[model samples]
Each structure stands twice: as C-alpha cells, then as structure tokens.
Target: MITDDTTVNGVRIGGAEAGSDQGARTIELPSGARAEVRKGYGRDLMRAQRATAGGDANAVVFALIAEVTRVDGRKIVYEDVLEMDLADVMALQAEVIDENFDRPPQRASQASSNQDSQSRS
Candidate 1:
C-alpha cells in the first residue's frame, strides 16, 4: 500500500493529499516552522497533567503543546517549547486551543445587547 505520493522515508504522510487524518492538523509557526499537531490522546493529556501538576496555567499549556506537536519532522519536547520565542509559542498555543478546546456558542445577551448605544440603569 505504499504509494510514491504518500510515502516518504518509509513513513506515510497524513494530510491534505493523503485525505486528512482525523484529529490532526498542520500549523505554520510565526518562526517559519511547520508543525504537525494532533489531538492529544488520553495518555498524552495525562502525561501533560502529571508534568504540570501544581504548576501555573502557562506550564500546562507548554506541556500540552510539547506532548502533541511535531515540528519540521522532529518531536519537540517541553524544554524545546520553553526555549522557543514568545510569538511562536503563542501561535502554537492558539492552534492547540483551536484543536483541543470547544468554543461555546455566542451568548444571547451579547448577541442582542448594545445595538442602540442606550445605557439602561
């Protein structure tokens, strides 16, 4: 089942031309690096959770990103992400959030309010 268009270096490619992999997406970083990110499995999430236990929110984000992202065909570890530029980290953060977090629907109050600029007491 190895096709020239799909296999590279004995590994199968998994995006766009390959028909897309479920729970996986590619992210282009601000630093000009391309990363393949996949939804974290339960074990991946647990690993991040354990590593970030008692740490700040940012620590959790960093750990999760490290656990799920592969940049330029290389697996980046937590320390690698820690050393990345702030902008790149933020870009990855946005992608990770987009992939893993579900956005709630717009609130009715926000959708309906403030149309006339009249302040109600």
Candidate 2:
C-alpha cells in the first residue's frame, strides 16, 4: 500500500510505505517442502536496513553510520535513497516476467532433445 505521509526519525517519508521483503528461500529440507533463499545481511546489517525504513533514517542512520564507520566516503542523497526502491521494483518485475512468460530455454531444450531422438530413431 502507498502512504501519503508518514514520519520516521522526524523526516516526512512519502512514496510507498517501505514494505518488508518476503519471498521463498532454500534450506536443508527434511521432506517435500520447497524452499528458497531470501537474501539479507546479518544483524550487523540493521544500519543498512534503516535506509529502507524511509525518511531521514536512510541518510541519518544508514548513510551517516556508514560514513562514520568509514565503510565509504559518500553521502546518500534523497534520489539515491529512492533509487533503492525503484531498483527493487524493477528486480521484482524481472522475476515475475521470467516466472510467468520466460519459456524459451525450456522450449529450445525440449526441441533439441526431440531432434536428437528423431535422429537416433
């Protein structure tokens, strides 16, 4: 859902409410249940996560923390912060397109197998 206005760490955050990332992940399976790996950094990653919490958190907590820690000598601007969101949306769209409509590989492989079988016969 989209949020018209919200505050986080005092800055007004607009655009979409930063939704939590969720997806299937793989692990050691005991039986028939399928799984996938939803990638994330370890708890040492909380500072990075604050960026997604929106508003000043991106620059205040995440950006500043990284700068102070000397992770990088850079400042996260407003557009840069928003690009993170835009990037994710594009990534999600690619995955959805691949899952739903990308069948060229499968079709080509199957066709190759059929040609091989016909030649052998």
lDDT of each residue in 6-120, candidate 2, tens digit only = 7667433554223212442233223322223233223324545555466544344333222112102233332443444444433333432333232555355788999999999
lDDT top scorer: 1
Residues 1-121, candidate 1, lDDT per residue (tens digit)? Answer: 5453586654345433232256678878889999888776655676687898886778888998998888898878889999999999988998887656567886768635775345653
Q: Residue 22 in model 2: shift from native, Å?
A: 2.1
Predictions in order: lDDT: 0.75, 0.37
Clashing pairs in 2: 25-35, 25-36, 25-37, 26-36, 26-37
Q: Model 1, residue 68: displacement in angstroms?
A: 1.1
- Candidate maximizing TM-score: 1
Error of 1 at 90 (Å): 0.7
